[model samples]
Target: MQDYAKLRKAVEMQSNEMKRIHDVHIDYWKECSMFFSPVRGRFLLSDKNKDFKKFHNIINNTGLRALRTLVSGLMTGVTNPARPWFRLSTPDPSLRESYNVKIYLEEVERRMRYVFQKSNLYNVLPQCYKELGLFGTANLNIDEDFEKVIHCTNFTCGSYYIAQNDKLEVDTTIRRLNKTPRQLVREFGLDKVSAPVKSLYEKHNTEGDVSITVAIMPNEDRDFGRAMDKENMPYIQVVYEDDAPKDKVLAVSGYHEFPQATPRWEAVGEDVYSISPCMEALGDNKQLQHEEKSKAKSLDKMNNPPLVAPASMKNTPVSALPSGITFEDSQSEGKGLRSLYEVRTPIGELTNDIQEVQRRISSALYEDLFLMLANDRRSGITAREVEERHEEKLLMLGNVLQQLNNELLDPIIDRTFAIMARNNLLPTPPEELQGVTLKIEYISVLHQAQNAVALRAIERSYAFVSGLVGLYPEARHKFDSFQAIDEYGEYAGVPSKIIKTNDAASQAQKAEQQQQAQAQAMEMMQQGAQTAKDASQIDTEKLQELTGA
Candidate 1:
């Protein structure tokens, strides 16, 4: 019923566009591939004559090491130890008083974490790092099944591309999969086919073939239902070609978004490829060092030369001569005798150059920061200084982290929450909070660290104002004490449960004021009663004096 030919043509067009970008970046990809697997590099594979093998013996993998280090650092910051990866909050600050909503959100977060843990998201996350490291982009697909409410799968680079869209969200994505006919039939519920077709599918079940799966949100105005009705095919399965509902498939992309001007989607992210020149130099330096060492060994072997003699004395060997043996020549007084040629190859400069290149490579990958932390204790560096240095490195990743939050973490959480909501795994919100939408707050160490910069600035400003207030008491009124406390608590990553809401704080203040007023009234009444008793005593003394007269 659906126009299969038209869809295939659109797919082919998208593929061709993506291929063009891939071709332009093939060299960079080859370098990254070689960094991980040297033999995969075009330069290594093109050695049909086996010439490079003889000279370039050492294939340094520092490039791969740097890539892994960067990836690990990113993961560590993203999943910080001090806080959860994400939490739910209300967009309206005043809603903090709604404890029921707060509790419901907390439950949502707990369930989300449980789902992720059950689905093995921790393992899936590393694949994303690999993709990001190699291709500067990562794709994560979220789906649901009977066994797992929310399941996640990672797609490697070059296997998927985004379609044209006016908004930032990915509405359509085309992915290539290699599956057997049997798998396709089983997955898509194609068992309703005729007997002969079933037999044919079973025959080729073992032989897998590549298939393209396109996910798109169809236009509402399109007559897809009419087309299916005309074909008399199954409504959902025939249209989607999958057993699962179309809306359940969520595709999320991480890192740089594709440029609008380009015909195809291309990720322009920062990665090891950004420092390709340094990585290339490191590899070359390593090969050169190996070559120099080989040369040095060859020179050492040629330190002593064997004497050459006429045909009559050809049988004489160099080992037969003694250490101090004198060479005697029957003709020309040994003038034509062979002489030792001293060969000297200085490797000190080569070693220094290699070391310098290694340093440059390390600098390019921010490895120097790690080294600083390693030596900080021994060097007696203060903790504050170490933290400041750490922040400097984290600042470099601010943009990438923001993208990951938007394109990776947020989508994953939203999809998981939606699945849970559909399954009724979340707590019921109170009537007041029924219409309120939950927002995500990232409290991971990296996010907190990002906030720390602004927090530090606030602290400095407060300290400076306090110093002025100390000099002039009247300056205290200029400071907003409560606002400062609240802002500090928020930026300091303090848990919401631990901090009192504004309404509660105001109630406590009013109660304290009432108690103070009652105490003051009781004191006034007690003083009045004492004054009346003193006056009564004075009148009694005066009457006693008059009776005595």
Candidate 2:
């Protein structure tokens, strides 16, 4: 029911573009093209350029050209306009990292050709005489419906697409069967099957009109022998043919198709034919599904917010403290305690708000940086360029954040500590202090944490920006929300508490002990209001008379 053709084309287009890059990457591996090596330097293939070139030329000259000619001639049983047949293999993830495109291609073709022939056998044989079916196995005298009989082939890769008529679906060269060779030999007997049985029980046979073969022609240098085996492993081949005969036929020699006794043998060629018109139509339908899925995925990410702090905290206000001394500390006994109260309520709100702003900005930056790194993986952007841009942006952001820290947070932090020190709330100084302390250690910790938040934000911003550019390098200007933090802007004033003096030790002790007193006071106020409400429930005149109003 699926339009496999369109899907195939979409996959083809996308894959081709990706494959071009992959092919370039292949060349890159041989030439040591990439700057950053994820696997360090050991396994990279820089020294094998000359060997790879020679290897490719050998296949193009011999095996592939012959295979193409053979495929064209064998299609409709006559040699004419030959349709070009490309190589295919099992979809092996492990093999991709160490892909031997040339050798793997040959092995796949060979196995596929073998599987295709066997698959055709079921269709040509009479239904009653078909030896491969479930019904024929149980009863040798049953009538078989060749018309109703739909032959199926279980390929080495377990892909059913080969059974279809429209497309050539090939998988990577990774074996999907779980059974071990010994287990297979004990169960299925390797002697009964073909010679190049890498593992036992791996049934490499053809069920339908599809051509399946174990394409194996390893080159000396590129073969990599045991190493390549560990990487791609080998896969079984399967093929099917819908137009083959439906009635049983007499037994024939498997090797009779290829008359040559030598390894360099030729296959019978058939007439070339264009793909069926019906199959072309199927390709269109599959393309639509791929587009819809891609669009939906894009929308989902757009709708989601950055995974971080609450929305309310995204924006924060700058500080604006009045230049009044109404609450100025005068009492030496209350110096340290004065700092807490000396900072006006509005100023406190402003400072908290500003801190939130800094936090958000920094977070955004860090996220941007991470996104950039991600983009580089897909966008062909070099890591060095991304890093360079990241450094520039980070320096700019750090400067702004540093300036803001100095102008806004620093002063408030200084004032707060001064108040704490005066009230004896801070730890006793190693030495008696008279003038402005070099640094307020308490605020310094908080400041350092804030700085970290800011620095990380810059990192994130770089990541996000890099990703945006990678995804849409040509149109990245549209995402202006990722504005640089270094743009010149007026800074908000620092918030500060009134400078007051107090009995440092006594006030510090009282603040600790009187925390319970504050709670008690609040409770008393609640009780008083409750009592007043109860008294007010009585008539107003009676309440007024009782209180001698």
Candidate 3:
């Protein structure tokens, strides 16, 4: 006996609470998106085409180009589609290096990449990243697809509502989506949907899309000791027609993990929503547009200034068109459509100001920082040198990148791994690695810059030790060579197969030492036997001399 009313009430309460805080951000987000991104805002029915048709406000396209570059830069720096930018490892470094675990994790990484490539992840990811830049908060749903192995759906900021737990982690996701009647029935089936939805479906009333709410929240009854199934799992999903009776749920299901990843760039204290660089630079964006608009008007006046005519020629029509003769009075010869106030607009200075504002907007969005690698014109510069050149930028983004790893990439990979494991698409883990938890290590370009600090430390330490080795060769004993090798391998992105596990390396060392010990003992025994033979010959000669033979 599922309490449909209770479930609906809980979902509505959570959603209402989320929307209460979320509405404040929506007001500004509407303005922000209008200027930079060309995408239409689909938050409300009234706001549908209102924001959609307002792209004319963007008199300058600098913001648009900067945002596009921001998206591409993020893709290259964080999760490059062309490379395996992340890896799976256990918390125990030694465990990660074990041959079996290493092979299994590699297989897992390979499979996950395949799934990502097959799915719409790479395509929709830019949308998510774009929303993140524009709104500071972005939601992406990672779900299972039988054919694709994994499926990704990105929700623009205002279209969704989310609640955070006590730890400020988003565990509740409520999406207000518009689905056609046919879509509802196809998804939940005829018998599962509400009466209103079914009526429209059966009558072929597909005239317009109807709004529905889907809620993903904690299953409150899981603690009541009910048998665990899809419906009774830890987190539950409830989808229902918004206009249907409040007591009926369209569909009910559950997930072992939170399938939605909601990432916020700069979350203020205790707020569910976040503020982004778009919001920060929105003032400059508007100023830039205004400046550009003013410049256009100035140019317009210069090209076609307003005209004034004398009373004598008031009856005659003025021909402003090109190659048209106006019967302007021979009396109005000096006043025949001449320049108005000499049209003095400083075109060069206005352009300089507009460019300055555009540069400010780009800086707010970290455009220069993100595209530092792409913008570099240096020849023969290694990746490390480029990273070193922009190390400060990476440090600036350190906090955001950490949050991105936790809020976005972590859950995405975790959900995909779960789907693959559920479908038996992965190899079984070794018994030794049975209980060890898998962790994701981002080795992307941005993360490499973060690790470069530690790598530099290692390099400096080795250089110091090399200098001291001639004077104090035993100073090498202070640092553990094996641990240094392990860390270097990890930070250097060395393949796991290239490095042996700590246990394996230790065992090999012990075997070599045992062989050396055994050979030394055998040599000592042979030397003693040779000396004994020499003593025996001396004894024989002495005895012969004493007997006078």
| Candidate with maximal TM-score | 3
Lowest-sum lDDT 10-residue window in model 3: 45-54
- Write one digit per residue (lDDT tens) for candidate 1, span 1-549: 335445444445665675464456556655555444243322221222223443244455555566566556556657533347787888877675677776777777787787777785677776676566555556676766567776667765445555434554544454544454575566555554334335658677544442435433323224534543322322111122222333322121121121111111123332112223234344554554465566567565566544455654454443445574544457645554564454455667656775666676666655576456557746997545556878877776676677677667777777677667767888888786767887888877567767777778788988988999878989889887666766776765676677776777889989999999999999999999999988777776678899995
lDDT value, candidate 2, whole model: 0.29
Per-prediction TM-score to the true structure, in the order listed:
0.71, 0.15, 0.88
Candidate order by TM-score, decreasing, is 3, 1, 2
Q: Score residue 213 of candidate 2 by CA lDDT.
A: 18
For all predictions, the C-alpha RMSD in Å is 8.0, 39.7, 5.4
Segments in model 2 whose C-alpha atoms lie over 4 Å from true places: 21-26, 33-549
Model 1 residue runs over 4 Å out of place are 37-58, 80-83, 167-171, 189-344, 370-385, 431-437, 513-549
Positional deviation of residue 395's Cα in model 2 after best superposition, in angstroms = 6.1
lDDT sort, best first: 3, 1, 2
User: lDDT (CA) for every model shown?
Assistant: 0.57, 0.29, 0.84
Taking the tens digit of each residue's C-alpha lDDT, what string does model 3 give over 470-491? 7998998897878888898788
Q: In lDDT terms, which candidate is top?
A: 3
Deviation from truth (RMSD, Å), model 2? 39.7
User: Which digits, one per residue and each the tens of the lDDT, describe model 2 over residues 1-549?
Assistant: 213233233333443343333343233232211111111111222221223333332211222222222222222111111221222222432222222432433443344334324333223222111111111010111111243221232221011111111221112111112223444344445453333332323454322112221211112122324443321223212211112132211111111011110100111122111121112222222233333344444444444312332334334332224663333234333332111222123434444554443333323223344345446546886534544556654443344334323322233233333333334444433222223124321122112323344455566776787787877796556543312322100010011111111233347768988998999999999999999999878898887999999
